[model samples]
Target: MALTFHTGEVGVSRAEVTSIVADALRREAFTEALVATYVWGKGKRGTPRGSGPATLQKILAAEGLDVALAAAVTVLHEHGSQEAYAALHQQIPELGPSFFTKFLYFTGKTLPPANGPEPLILDRVLSLRLRSLAVTVGRETGHDPDGSVAAWVWADWNWSPHRYGIYLSFMHAAARQLAGTDSWPSDAAPDLLECALFNSAWEPSS
Candidate 1:
């Protein structure tokens, strides 16, 4: 569905979703990308969550909204350090790690990060999943034997750039490991792993 970012009006037609994203990527249109990603991510919950002209106005009015997005574009296209890219974005209000990460994920569809895994959405679900793994690993290793470091690093929200760096590194590693298995395609993108984890398939269900 097409989205009017200035007004936050949801457009008709499910088929437009792909086309809108395609158009955004084709032209590197930040506004269109913002609309497409936000609409696509919110899906059915947009309207009830107070997605309207007023809310959208607030979003657009946020100081450094445009500047931050511009920096994101540079980071994505130039393959700048992902941790610094993440740190650059954390200051923007109205856009959090969850949503802004979606924007990053969409914008970077054309180029993989130079030094690490491409940006993937790191919402609450994925963070908690990481938290569980951290707790387990902490238990096994003396480094975080009490899981306190795990809790601090993998908190449900407001993750630091260092933590984001760790997350990207881990996701890429997990993606590589999954590719080695018969069930996963060798060329599958890391975001596919992000999707799987978000869809209730975190780790092997054992």
Candidate 2:
């Protein structure tokens, strides 16, 4: 089996990508807990409560924290993505790319309803795995995979409307490929694929 790329290109697919995610989802342990945290403001062991950045801060905040920061977080939780981004930009101007992207993920997860596009988490694990897949495809095809889609993600593109659109498009493509399959849970193709990629990247080496 070959994993399809954004440009309609194909690379040899690793079976473990699907298998690990499927196995994890079948157990419904870690994955379910994470989903619960995202859907509801409930913490699970190491995972904190709240899905959005500000909401997450509010959930994790201790007693007698900065009053202003707490107020800002409350405002961020109440608004949509654009407002949340603006709030984050003003509050945490020094935040890095990863934080911004994760903020987007959490915002998407919390704001959207069940039938909406499942938020794809673009953390270090997922990014590294995606780059590795791109490298594999490049080696096989003798063409640099640092094209638009790959560059937008792997090159650390900033969070913008255009970048977010590209990211959603890529996830939607992957979801379409994995749709209507029993490899994981139903109606969660994108997230299932993302979990598979993350697990394959982060799994301990023997």
Candidate 3:
């Protein structure tokens, strides 16, 4: 299906875009993959392109982008490593974890093995969910009983790499937990859970 923007503009169909991005990744066309991810995903929103495309242009033209993207691919699809994740954190100029992690998440979909936990989107919505859970757990455990710290850590944007790693692990674990159940499939991707949390409310179990 095509992801039509709120502006009533028709873009490429979802399957076509996914194939294009997957081919780009297989060809080591990181810049194209990144651009396709944004244009097809967030950029489709009615919001102005802003500095996003310009920033991407500058970063993609730089020499070190290949190294960063390559390492990200290796870690995300080949080895599934936190060390590489740390190294990739904010490596791209003007690109933050929120955006780059989306790239990684899409890459995980196109690529296989994941070698371990698959990468998934961790935008503000997902972080907010995590924050709510952290706060609830903290209250129950008497740690950060006021949830002040939890809210601070799970801010709307620019999360630290360590926190990003925590999100990946948490999401993958939750996906596994939901799988093989009555409603969730045994082979469901973690992104499914991420999307669910993004669209719903989170509350601590009593």
Candidate 3 per-residue lDDT over residues 1-206, each given as its tens digit: 22233444566754676687799988999877877766655543223224444565666676787788877887766677454466578787766666676677677667753565666666666777788888988899998999999999898777777777787788888778878987778998777777667767323346
The global Cα lDDT (0 to 1) of model 3 is 0.70
Best candidate (score: lDDT): 3
Clashes of each: 1, 0, 0
Query: Regarding TM-score, does 1 or 2 come out ahead?
Result: 1
Model 1 residue pairs with clashes: 1-17
Model 2 lDDT tens row, 49-163: 2224444344334343233233323343464434433443334333333444443444344334233343445544456667677666665676864544555456543355444
Query: What are the runs in model 1 whose C-alpha is more than 4 Å off?
Result: 1-19, 25-28, 44-56, 81-84, 142-145
lDDT of each: 0.67, 0.43, 0.70
Residue 71 miss distance in model 3 (angstroms): 3.1
The regions of model 2 sitting more than 4 angstroms off are 1-91, 113-118, 145-153, 156-161, 182-186, 201-206
The CA lDDT at 140 in model 2 is 60
- Order by lDDT, highest first: 3, 1, 2
- Over 32-145, each residue of candidate 1 has an lDDT whose tens digit, in order, gives 666667666665322223445455556667787766676677776666447535645557666667666767776666544565667777777788778888888888777898
**Candidate 3: residue 66 lDDT (0-100):** 78
- Give every collision pair in model 2: none
